[model samples]
Target: MDVDPLLTQARQLWIELAGAPVAFPTRGVAVVASAESSTCPPGWVGIVALGDAAICTVPTDDLVGVVTRACHMLPVAALTDPERLAAVLPVTQVLGPATLAYCDDHSYRPQRRQPIEQLPVHHPDLVDFLASVPAEDAAECGLTDITSAAYVLRAGTAIVAAAGYRHWPRRVAHLSVLTAPSRRGRGLARAVAGAATADSLADGLVPQWRARPAASRRVARALGFRELGAQLSVRVGGSDQTRLGPGSNTTAP
Candidate 1:
């Protein structure tokens, strides 16, 4: 009867693990990354509430511990552990003995993006366009069924920019394949973003862009994606860094 509690728990754990808002966090929050993104009946789901935090479970005692003790924290903190972070997949954790020092901060908030009227679909010259890109990039974009999802702008494709989503449900869509470095200063980001936002709106979902660079957020602004705040990824046995959770956004949802 009351699914709100389960939904809240799953969403919170998803935010903790994935570092972004999740639209439909599954009933098994402890294993959310591995769980199928399906909504479950409230009665079938178990809940574990601790202080201000709660996690959805599969009606098992061990699952309760994993959800309450292990899986509930800000993403930035959880990401520091290699084994734990690996479970989240696609998100890299900086290991020790690395050259780069990890840091956390929001560089800036992007300006609001203007809407786009028409996006020209690329024609049969498309083979050359597809050839320019790697297959992994295409797979990432096509994860959400947006057809013709390949081609980065810097490769000198006509579209100027390309973008696509990873379905974490409506509350969260990972925006990937933003643009190539050589394609900067064009309105490609706006065009691609406008199209993606329109798709999300059509699906009755809220779009949350993930892990965008500070410069990329400028493009996001033109495409109607305000910052959900900056997220941090720290390396193990690395130098000290301050971390914030969901507070560094220039624009709040």
Candidate 2:
């Protein structure tokens, strides 16, 4: 109910330990006991309480362990201990999917690399872009509109990199940026991310970042988004009884 207090507290902890950029909280989400608040940035979507006592509003898994240390919390029980669902929260009722992870935003620092000229959507180019990344990974990343996705090129032929963003309510926008393994270390990721950030800022939508691996947090830090903390999204049966935090008894052991 009172997520702000936890969000505020997480912000302070994230900055101190994670060296993350700055991050904000989103609205309309339940707040865990440790999180300061549920209010997030226009692009960010949810607020997750970290074990180390931070709240992640952005998309950085790097800090999950950090939070665990601080909060004396365990790794997401859902993934590791699926049967332990009842221990954390009730599984019978409508407890949202307990997909928990730590997150944070890096302050947006301008990328110092040379810019890549924008290229229009060419079906071949889009296919090429998709081909560069692992097929399954790409799908998992939610690459549906290859034509609408943004890309960077080199030598006028090679589809070096690409990224995409999707909009959500509460001013939240999702980010999915990818670079070819061969073309990495060339700032292509940053270029695509810059495009997404510019668009979000222009539209006044808060970008909710969810980096799959821990390394991607660097990209967010360079962009000026701060770290919010981790979150747990549990989707159980459609019932009001399944809620997170200390007061909410819906959670199982």
Candidate 3:
């Protein structure tokens, strides 16, 4: 695979979404933040790391200083670890410590053995497919929310698997893939995801795979997506935007 462009593209994509790079006490870990951080998935803090470079977005500006301090003090491993993030903030909920991956023209292994149908992401067939999935699985996969056209594998009128991408900042195709619980273990996720990813690349979009579940990650790996780093979203306090981020709070992971 082409390493230089991949590295540069991945690094710049996160910078655009989160913020510009800033100095950190740690050598390997660089930090960045921007106004966009406020909208970052309703978490106390959202950190998108590539290799040793971590781009963090907190809900508020005041938290930047405290989060930065924690970045300097925490090891790279700790910074990327969702539970370990409690060392700095209140740490109410953790969304991920997910593996971040990207695909290159050379690396992507398109799965063409299975037939796939492309449709508007919100099409009824795709909607019903998502509806058939277990609630928890549907929520976790986030496929129903994709803005790109869907690539689907159907079982009669029902969709057994689906894949698409959310249009994220920096033209990133944040890939979403879901296989119905009853239809899994059939290589269905990869077959459809491969089509969606191929289409995204053809349109000159960068494909991103933020895989949380081991099964999802496995499918991404099988399609030749290269894992680069991790993403961890931390939220503290109750429903209120409390002081955990900016003020003093030291809870261990």
Candidate 4:
């Protein structure tokens, strides 16, 4: 499979952050390595692979031990190195795998030529409007100066959809989006996402759309985003925490 240049660059950044040698895995495998301090969540090591990467901040490097009991659940080929494979596995048994999607200027298409409102992060109305959404969504959309830009779609006085990006390493934009539940299925998510992605491209930032839903993937595909690959996430506890799909919290290119 042809790797997107942007994806390659993202992988390089992750490898550098991991402070480990690059080990791009084959089509259906994952690789794990020690991560630099604070590069990943506390207590876990960062794992990166072309197919299913993960950051396990679990404070221990004994992944081999964890996978030993579940050896039968994984593919034999994927167990070439139990320790490395464990790093990419779900931190817990309950949480399913996650995915990371991304797009560059070459892949993104700003097709939704609808009117989008660029709202000030500190605007009173925007602040009040964001309060109605999830805290993570508001923070991801630039609750402060950390965001590069944010855009929204309004119907009358109500904000129906919003999109934005936070600055990530290597000039990448971690894009996020949200659409009101009552206003979903109307393509509002795609419109706002396109607006924000276009702004990211204009500012020379690669938009990284990390999501886990088929619907969100469709919105991304509508805007010409491609699936870089899937990722895995397992919380320390049994809580099944995964990044929301497009239109809910995080969005695509």
Candidate 5:
């Protein structure tokens, strides 16, 4: 199957984030050890798949053995070398099969946006709003100075929904959006997400939305994101023991 050009670009951006050598094949799984600090979630590995190939980024080559085992859980049809993945690592610890989605300039379409307020992280109202939401939600939107930009929709003094992006390699924007529990099903999520995405595109960055919620995926589609592929993460213990399951408890992006 032919890989989407945008998906290919997204994979390359991830490889760059890993600080892997440019000579690394963009289409296969490899064990790369980089001293660089990862921008990805803590203890979570990243896998970018397109057509029949995948690029898996682990924090260190020491984890490569376990990463290969986790890759076995991926759908065979999606991997370029399932046999190799199975052969390399022991089937001991596997953590997840998370879905990752991406959107580029061509793939995104602006939706009818709501009246959103772009705010600095230090804005009093934004700060108060973050406090009102779950801590995980606040952190995901970069409450700690990680996002380059943020936008929120409010009902008077109360923030109903918010979205933002963090700087990722190759000018890619890692997008995150959240809607208050009581305010969901009102299109507020899409409204704020659309606003943030528009800003990212305006700044010449490709917005990437990675999450597992079907509702989140719907919001992404409404804003013109395409499902690129799924990622699998495995936890490697100190002694090479592996554990396999879903991702840890965290708010959806």
Candidate 6:
């Protein structure tokens, strides 16, 4: 697919995921208070900005004016910048500042590493595979909770690598991939993820890769995914505040 159209489609998928209908401003940022946003934790704020434009989602209508004012005061880039966003929004808690990347059929680069298996997301061997990885990695990848068919690689009977997607509205396949610590340096991540990405594309769903780790992002890029936007989830309410850094959670939906 042409990069422009692919990117536009990707942007539309995020707009639909924002829950309440809203569009990015031509300049600065657009803030919308909508309780329907699934991308944010219940009662949290969500920001999805493609390139220079942005749309912010808050829980209540009362906060829209404040958030709009605060967000508009800064550059649209601040929504993806944790420190800048936290300074302005009433960020009581935060989830990620993940890079939102998208891949389509034309741009996809399939890997030759093979013998991959397509399994249902809830296969029993998957639990053992998840147990083998670090808790933080498991939390970040979220492979066990994916709703799409899994593309996995195995070592004997042990599943060493896995990739899949959660079926989001608007034909978005949010991708998740994880490799065992022992299996990290191998090309298994690329193989399984490439398989999953190909499968998602074949099913006519846009594959969305939200990655926090550089390695994970590298895998997506290697598969020809373009970084089109950034997603951040913030809980806004009382005076209690926390910032995103080493200690904060980076897990996102």
TM-score of each: 0.42, 0.51, 0.82, 0.72, 0.76, 0.88
In terms of lDDT, the poorest run of 10 residues in model 6 is 244-253
Q: Give the winner by lDDT.
A: 6
Candidate 6 per-residue lDDT over residues 1-253, each given as its tens digit = 2348766776677677677878866666777776776656656777877877888877788888888888877887777787897787667666778888888888999889689998887788888777777887777677767888888899999999898888877788888888888778777888998998898999999988887778888888999999987888777766223332211222221
Question: Across residues 168-235, which tens digit of lDDT does each residue of candidate 4 receive?
Answer: 77787777777776787899989988887888888888787766567677877887877665444333
- TM-score attained by model 5: 0.76
Clash count per candidate = 2, 67, 1, 8, 7, 0
What TM-score does candidate 2 get on C-alpha atoms?
0.51
Global Cα RMSD, each model: 11.9, 12.1, 5.9, 5.8, 5.0, 4.1
Clash count for candidate 2 is 67
Candidate 5 displacement at residue 131 in angstroms: 1.0
- Model 4 steric clash pairs: 43-57, 43-58, 43-59, 44-56, 44-57, 44-58, 45-56, 91-234
Q: Over 4 Å off in model 1, which ranges?
A: 1-67, 71-127, 134-136, 147-157, 164-177, 185-187, 199-205, 212-218, 227-253
lDDT of 1 at 206: 48
Instruction: Tally clashes: model 6.
Output: 0
Best by TM-score: 6
Q: Rate the local accuracy (lDDT) of all candidates.
A: 0.36, 0.44, 0.70, 0.58, 0.63, 0.77
User: How close to the true structure is residue 55 of candidate 2, measured as C-alpha lDDT?
Assistant: 36
The sequence of per-residue lDDT tens digits that candidate 5 reaches over residues 99-163 is 56677778788778467888876778777777887776765544344365568888987877777
Q: Write the per-residue lDDT of candidate 1 for residues 7-101, one digit (tens) a residue.
A: 34334444454322233333222333212212221112222222233233222234334434434543423422446644633322331211110
lDDT of 6 at 8: 74
Q: Pick out the ten consecutive residues of candidate 3 with the lowest summed lDDT.
A: 244-253
